[model samples]
Target: DQQVKQNSPSLSVQEGRISILNCDYTNSMFDYFLWYKKYPAEGPTFLISISSIKDKNEDGRFTVFLNKSAKHLSLHIVPSQPGDSAVYFCAASGYTNAGKSTFGDGTTLTVKP
Candidate 1:
Protein backbone atom coordinates (compact mmCIF):
# COMPACT_ATOMS: atom_id res chain seq x y z
CA ASP A 1 0.00 0.00 0.00
CA GLN A 2 3.03 2.34 -0.18
CA GLN A 3 2.56 3.85 3.20
CA VAL A 4 5.47 5.49 4.96
CA LYS A 5 4.73 6.11 8.62
CA GLN A 6 6.10 8.61 11.08
CA ASN A 7 4.68 7.51 14.39
CA SER A 8 5.26 10.74 16.22
CA PRO A 9 3.46 13.81 15.02
CA SER A 10 5.90 16.09 16.82
CA LEU A 11 9.02 16.20 18.93
CA SER A 12 10.61 18.83 21.16
CA VAL A 13 14.13 19.20 22.43
CA GLN A 14 16.29 21.77 24.09
CA GLU A 15 19.05 23.53 22.24
CA GLY A 16 22.32 21.60 21.88
CA ARG A 17 20.59 18.28 22.47
CA ILE A 18 20.17 15.33 20.19
CA SER A 19 16.85 14.81 18.45
CA ILE A 20 15.79 11.48 17.07
CA LEU A 21 12.93 10.81 14.66
CA ASN A 22 11.69 7.44 13.53
CA CYS A 23 9.93 6.08 10.45
CA ASP A 24 8.61 2.79 9.12
CA TYR A 25 7.50 1.39 5.80
CA THR A 26 5.26 -1.43 4.71
CA ASN A 27 6.71 -1.75 1.22
CA SER A 28 9.87 -3.81 1.15
CA MET A 29 11.07 -2.71 -2.27
CA PHE A 30 11.89 0.90 -1.42
CA ASP A 31 15.60 1.21 -2.01
CA TYR A 32 16.39 4.90 -1.92
CA PHE A 33 15.66 6.83 1.24
CA LEU A 34 15.84 10.56 1.92
CA TRP A 35 15.09 13.07 4.61
CA TYR A 36 13.78 16.58 4.05
CA LYS A 37 13.56 19.57 6.33
CA LYS A 38 10.85 22.18 5.89
CA TYR A 39 10.26 25.55 7.44
CA PRO A 40 6.97 27.34 7.73
CA ALA A 41 5.53 28.42 4.36
CA GLU A 42 8.51 26.95 2.50
CA GLY A 43 9.17 23.83 0.52
CA PRO A 44 11.15 20.98 2.00
CA THR A 45 14.92 21.03 1.53
CA PHE A 46 16.92 17.85 1.10
CA LEU A 47 18.90 17.10 4.23
CA ILE A 48 20.41 13.64 3.78
CA SER A 49 19.84 10.34 2.05
CA ILE A 50 20.76 6.65 2.17
CA SER A 51 20.48 3.88 -0.34
CA SER A 52 19.06 0.57 0.83
CA ILE A 53 22.42 -0.96 0.11
CA LYS A 54 23.85 0.91 3.05
CA ASP A 55 22.84 1.06 6.70
CA LYS A 56 23.82 4.58 7.64
CA ASN A 57 24.47 7.99 6.16
CA GLU A 58 25.58 11.14 7.86
CA ASP A 59 26.07 14.79 7.03
CA GLY A 60 27.36 17.21 9.64
CA ARG A 61 24.82 17.31 12.44
CA PHE A 62 22.38 15.01 10.71
CA THR A 63 22.46 11.23 10.40
CA VAL A 64 20.05 8.65 8.98
CA PHE A 65 20.13 4.97 9.72
CA LEU A 66 18.22 2.23 8.00
CA ASN A 67 17.46 -1.26 9.20
CA LYS A 68 16.35 -3.27 6.24
CA SER A 69 15.51 -6.37 8.23
CA ALA A 70 13.13 -4.38 10.36
CA LYS A 71 11.83 -2.11 7.64
CA HIS A 72 12.60 0.86 9.82
CA LEU A 73 14.68 4.02 9.66
CA SER A 74 15.58 6.84 11.94
CA LEU A 75 16.98 10.36 11.74
CA HIS A 76 19.28 11.83 14.31
CA ILE A 77 20.04 15.50 14.77
CA VAL A 78 22.92 16.32 17.02
CA PRO A 79 23.10 19.42 19.15
CA SER A 80 19.68 20.56 18.01
CA GLN A 81 19.38 24.30 17.70
CA PRO A 82 16.58 26.83 17.70
CA GLY A 83 17.16 27.28 13.99
CA ASP A 84 16.33 23.60 13.56
CA SER A 85 12.72 24.04 14.53
CA ALA A 86 10.71 22.74 11.60
CA VAL A 87 8.98 19.76 10.04
CA TYR A 88 10.89 16.68 8.86
CA PHE A 89 9.66 14.22 6.30
CA CYS A 90 11.00 10.81 5.40
CA ALA A 91 10.77 9.79 1.75
CA ALA A 92 11.45 6.63 -0.17
CA SER A 93 11.92 5.66 -3.81
CA GLY A 94 12.40 2.40 -5.61
CA TYR A 95 12.58 0.53 -8.92
CA THR A 96 8.83 0.16 -9.08
CA ASN A 97 8.23 3.90 -8.78
CA ALA A 98 10.95 5.10 -11.15
CA GLY A 99 12.58 7.21 -8.46
CA LYS A 100 9.45 9.10 -7.49
CA SER A 101 9.44 9.60 -3.71
CA THR A 102 6.62 8.97 -1.27
CA PHE A 103 6.57 11.05 1.92
CA GLY A 104 5.62 10.48 5.52
CA ASP A 105 3.02 12.69 7.17
CA GLY A 106 5.96 14.55 8.73
CA THR A 107 7.18 15.28 12.23
CA THR A 108 7.42 18.78 13.64
CA LEU A 109 10.49 19.41 15.76
CA THR A 110 10.74 22.28 18.15
CA VAL A 111 13.98 23.35 19.77
CA LYS A 112 13.61 25.17 23.00
CA PRO A 113 15.95 27.90 24.15
Candidate 2:
Protein backbone atom coordinates (compact mmCIF):
# COMPACT_ATOMS: atom_id res chain seq x y z
CA ASP A 1 0.00 0.00 0.00
CA GLN A 2 1.16 3.56 -0.62
CA GLN A 3 1.90 4.99 2.78
CA VAL A 4 2.57 8.53 1.75
CA LYS A 5 0.40 10.50 -0.65
CA GLN A 6 0.18 13.98 -2.08
CA ASN A 7 -3.45 14.49 -2.94
CA SER A 8 -2.88 17.40 -5.24
CA PRO A 9 -0.69 16.52 -8.19
CA SER A 10 -0.11 20.14 -9.15
CA LEU A 11 -0.32 23.61 -7.73
CA SER A 12 -0.01 27.09 -9.24
CA VAL A 13 0.91 30.23 -7.41
CA GLN A 14 1.89 33.75 -8.29
CA GLU A 15 5.40 35.02 -7.80
CA GLY A 16 5.94 36.72 -4.45
CA ARG A 17 2.95 34.81 -3.09
CA ILE A 18 2.83 31.93 -0.69
CA SER A 19 2.88 28.37 -1.95
CA ILE A 20 1.51 25.69 0.27
CA LEU A 21 2.04 22.01 -0.52
CA ASN A 22 0.43 19.23 1.47
CA CYS A 23 1.12 15.57 2.18
CA ASP A 24 -0.46 12.79 4.13
CA TYR A 25 0.73 9.44 5.42
CA THR A 26 -0.98 6.38 6.77
CA ASN A 27 2.07 4.90 8.48
CA SER A 28 2.35 5.67 12.12
CA MET A 29 5.96 4.53 12.15
CA PHE A 30 7.11 7.69 10.46
CA ASP A 31 8.78 10.00 12.90
CA TYR A 32 10.52 12.34 10.50
CA PHE A 33 8.95 14.26 7.66
CA LEU A 34 11.05 15.82 4.93
CA TRP A 35 10.43 17.93 1.87
CA TYR A 36 12.51 17.80 -1.27
CA LYS A 37 12.54 19.91 -4.42
CA LYS A 38 13.52 18.54 -7.83
CA TYR A 39 14.02 20.08 -11.23
CA PRO A 40 13.58 18.20 -14.51
CA ALA A 41 16.81 16.21 -14.60
CA GLU A 42 18.45 17.01 -11.28
CA GLY A 43 18.23 14.96 -8.14
CA PRO A 44 15.85 16.02 -5.44
CA THR A 45 17.33 18.53 -3.02
CA PHE A 46 16.38 18.64 0.64
CA LEU A 47 14.27 21.65 1.38
CA ILE A 48 12.89 21.54 4.90
CA SER A 49 11.98 18.99 7.51
CA ILE A 50 10.26 18.46 10.85
CA SER A 51 10.15 15.85 13.55
CA SER A 52 7.00 14.31 14.97
CA ILE A 53 7.85 15.89 18.28
CA LYS A 54 7.62 19.37 16.83
CA ASP A 55 4.77 21.12 15.08
CA LYS A 56 6.81 23.29 12.82
CA ASN A 57 10.27 24.07 11.44
CA GLU A 58 11.41 26.97 9.35
CA ASP A 59 14.43 27.88 7.27
CA GLY A 60 14.63 31.09 5.33
CA ARG A 61 11.41 31.37 3.32
CA PHE A 62 10.51 27.72 3.62
CA THR A 63 8.62 26.21 6.53
CA VAL A 64 7.39 22.73 7.35
CA PHE A 65 4.55 21.81 9.65
CA LEU A 66 3.64 18.45 11.02
CA ASN A 67 0.45 17.29 12.67
CA LYS A 68 1.15 13.88 14.01
CA SER A 69 -2.39 13.33 15.16
CA ALA A 70 -3.66 13.72 11.63
CA LYS A 71 -0.70 12.15 9.94
CA HIS A 72 -0.40 15.25 7.86
CA LEU A 73 2.41 17.58 6.89
CA SER A 74 2.79 20.68 4.81
CA LEU A 75 5.48 22.83 3.24
CA HIS A 76 5.01 26.53 2.90
CA ILE A 77 7.12 28.80 0.75
CA VAL A 78 6.78 32.51 1.19
CA PRO A 79 7.40 34.96 -1.60
CA SER A 80 7.64 32.06 -4.02
CA GLN A 81 9.84 32.81 -7.03
CA PRO A 82 10.05 31.37 -10.50
CA GLY A 83 13.06 29.37 -9.47
CA ASP A 84 10.89 27.71 -6.85
CA SER A 85 8.87 26.04 -9.58
CA ALA A 86 9.61 22.34 -9.39
CA VAL A 87 8.37 18.98 -8.23
CA TYR A 88 8.23 18.72 -4.45
CA PHE A 89 8.31 15.34 -2.82
CA CYS A 90 7.29 14.54 0.71
CA ALA A 91 9.20 11.78 2.43
CA ALA A 92 8.90 10.01 5.72
CA SER A 93 11.38 7.97 7.69
CA GLY A 94 11.69 6.25 10.99
CA TYR A 95 14.42 4.47 12.92
CA THR A 96 12.78 1.14 12.16
CA ASN A 97 13.14 1.85 8.44
CA ALA A 98 16.92 2.05 8.61
CA GLY A 99 16.98 5.56 7.19
CA LYS A 100 15.15 4.49 4.07
CA SER A 101 12.33 6.86 3.24
CA THR A 102 8.88 6.47 1.76
CA PHE A 103 8.19 9.20 -0.75
CA GLY A 104 4.97 10.60 -2.12
CA ASP A 105 4.36 10.86 -5.84
CA GLY A 106 5.23 14.57 -5.61
CA THR A 107 3.42 17.79 -6.31
CA THR A 108 4.46 20.01 -9.19
CA LEU A 109 4.56 23.62 -8.12
CA THR A 110 4.41 26.33 -10.77
CA VAL A 111 5.18 29.86 -9.72
CA LYS A 112 4.02 32.32 -12.29
CA PRO A 113 5.37 35.81 -12.61
Which has the greatest lDDT? 2
lDDT of each: 0.93, 0.94
Q: For model 2, what is the alpha-carbon lDDT of residue 22?
A: 97
User: Per-residue CA lDDT of candidate 1, range 1-113, in tens?
Assistant: 54799999999999999999999998887898999999999989999999988999989999999999999999999989999999999998895663499899999999999
Off by over 4 Å in 1: 95-99
Residue 67 lDDT (model 2): 89
Tell me which residue pairs clash in candidate 2: none
Clashing pairs in 1: none
Give the TM-scores of the predictions, in the order they appear: 0.94, 0.96
**Looking at candidate 1, what is the lDDT of residue 44?**
93
Compute the lDDT for candidate 1: 0.93
Error of 1 at 34 (Å): 0.4
